[model samples]
Target: MNDPDRARPETPPGHRGVQYAGRALCWSLAGGMTTAAVDIVLAPGFHAWPVLWPLPWYLTCVSAVAWAVLRAREKAAALRLAADEDLVQGQDWERAA
Candidate 1:
């Protein structure tokens, strides 16, 4: 039943609901903007918190994404660790004396 014509190209999904990277970036940017806006609204001080309106939001988004990505990676690693059984393979577990 081998059919060379039946081969399918594969594409993987990205993290969290955002599949496309560009789309994720755009959304992240919007989230960052919202964060900054909220901050400005909550604590109004143009002179003291001048940079909070623009930079923090973007940085916040970056940090949030980075954290989520890192967390995902960590979770994957932990799962892999649980499945690791190299010691049980190609060997015998006789009592060492």
Candidate 2:
């Protein structure tokens, strides 16, 4: 089996931007759940995330961001030519000089 942790080429920042936005959306959902649970059960003085107040809006935003990221990935994948086309010009990375 191949290791999935092999280094990826530097994708354009647009790809990264979409990915990070999706991550934030996930965090927002998690944080909101924690905050709401705390409010319903914990005492008043405990620290809580700001996620609860947005409620439905946060969920909607997260869903939208996820959809956008999926679309972007599809587009990028469609544009990629092939494995051999994305190679270093001179030599293989694992070979001796």
Candidate 3:
């Protein structure tokens, strides 16, 4: 999974924190606003079980955030690799044989 050769957008060195904050804000606003709207609409139907009304929508938002974080971490791991040691080893093996 930590393949350094993958193509991705290169973020500037010092702005990584800002970029992360922007992403978090976007996801938070989208999930919160959409879920709030849906909960309001469903409130009339599930008046008795108010807790269950927003459960599904909130769970979906959480799952989406989790998925995004998983992908970002995977990409970060790939980017952190200094070099592909295996490629050098493969070249050596080829030369020896």
Candidate 4:
């Protein structure tokens, strides 16, 4: 009964924070986009649309930035994990010698 993950190192606290932040950002952006869509659809006419026009653009930019940040954090965590695994394996080899 070999559990593969037993030897893996735990993720850093900051990694979890990044994940949580990304989730929050995604949900908030989704809510904003949904609200914006409803507002645009139910508006009286084009005359009153200017106020709600920039919501999509703003949300898009923010979403892009958040996506990039999350991706970067994920990559960093993966690299760290790989390094830790290598270190652990090296120690095991040394002990076997």
Candidate 5:
């Protein structure tokens, strides 16, 4: 059977503003921390990154980048959902974008 809730107009989450702000803060801080940790472990050759860095450092950096990338992907998915909701409810797309 079709779901009745599907036809209802969507409302923005009550905490949407704070939730997105928190996500942005966390994303930037985590990305910076990852790069900084790699710089610490790689010592003088961090500028060269995975190229000149030792195997362990390279692996760690790779993992950090992967984590950040995945977080970004999740953020994009969240934004997409918000945008979809906004479209359904006749809201402006600016915030969701």
Candidate 6:
């Protein structure tokens, strides 16, 4: 039987990386907004200090998580490409034998 996945064209890693980056940015924005909302609700008055206090920490955490995810994706793509190359090489060897 023919495989469905083999018929489809593979997306470039850079395109996938862009998608992941966009998703990460969206999630980070949502988290920052939620944090701001909570700060606003809990604080007595509209104080810039309380609302803005978590900005640095939130940014740092988001950057770290995004970086890790992108790095992992890069590594996984590299491994997959290498595996594919190995398979092709093995098939060529088999044909030659």
lDDT of each: 0.55, 0.59, 0.58, 0.69, 0.57, 0.68
Report the C-alpha lDDT of model 1 over 1-97, residue by residue, as the tens digit: 2236545223222333333433556666786677677776777756856675666556557656865775576567555644443343323344332
Question: Tens digit of lDDT per residue, candidate 5, span 39-94?
Answer: 68756653566554344444545555665666666667668876776676554345
The count of residue-pair clashes in candidate 2 stands at 0
lDDT of 5: 0.57
**lDDT of model 4 at residue 24?**
63
Model 2, 7-96: lDDT tens digits are 545664366666666776777777667766766787355344344455745775866667587767756764662333445422454343
Q: Arrange candidates by lDDT, highest first: which order?
A: 4, 6, 2, 3, 5, 1
- Model 1 ranges off by over 4 Å: 1-52, 85-97
Q: Could you say which candidate leads in TM-score?
A: 4
Predicted structure 5, TM vs. truth:
0.37
Cα RMSDs of all predictions?
Answer: 10.8, 9.3, 9.5, 5.1, 11.4, 7.1
Instruction: Estimate the TM-score of every prediction.
Output: 0.38, 0.44, 0.36, 0.54, 0.37, 0.49
Candidate with more favorable, higher lDDT: 4 or 6 = 4
Which residue pairs clash in candidate 3?
none
Clashing residue pairs in candidate 6, if any? none
**lDDT preference between candidates 1 and 4, better one:** 4
Ranking by TM-score: 4, 6, 2, 1, 5, 3
Cα miss at 2, model 1 (Å)?
44
Predicted model with the maximum lDDT: 4
**Candidate 6 lDDT by residue in tens digits, 7-71:** 53376466576566656667677777777677677764656766575775577577667767777
How many clashing pairs in candidate 4?
Answer: 0
Clash totals in order:
0, 0, 0, 0, 0, 0
Superposed model 6: Cα runs more than 4 Å off? 1-12, 15-47
RMSD of 1: 10.8
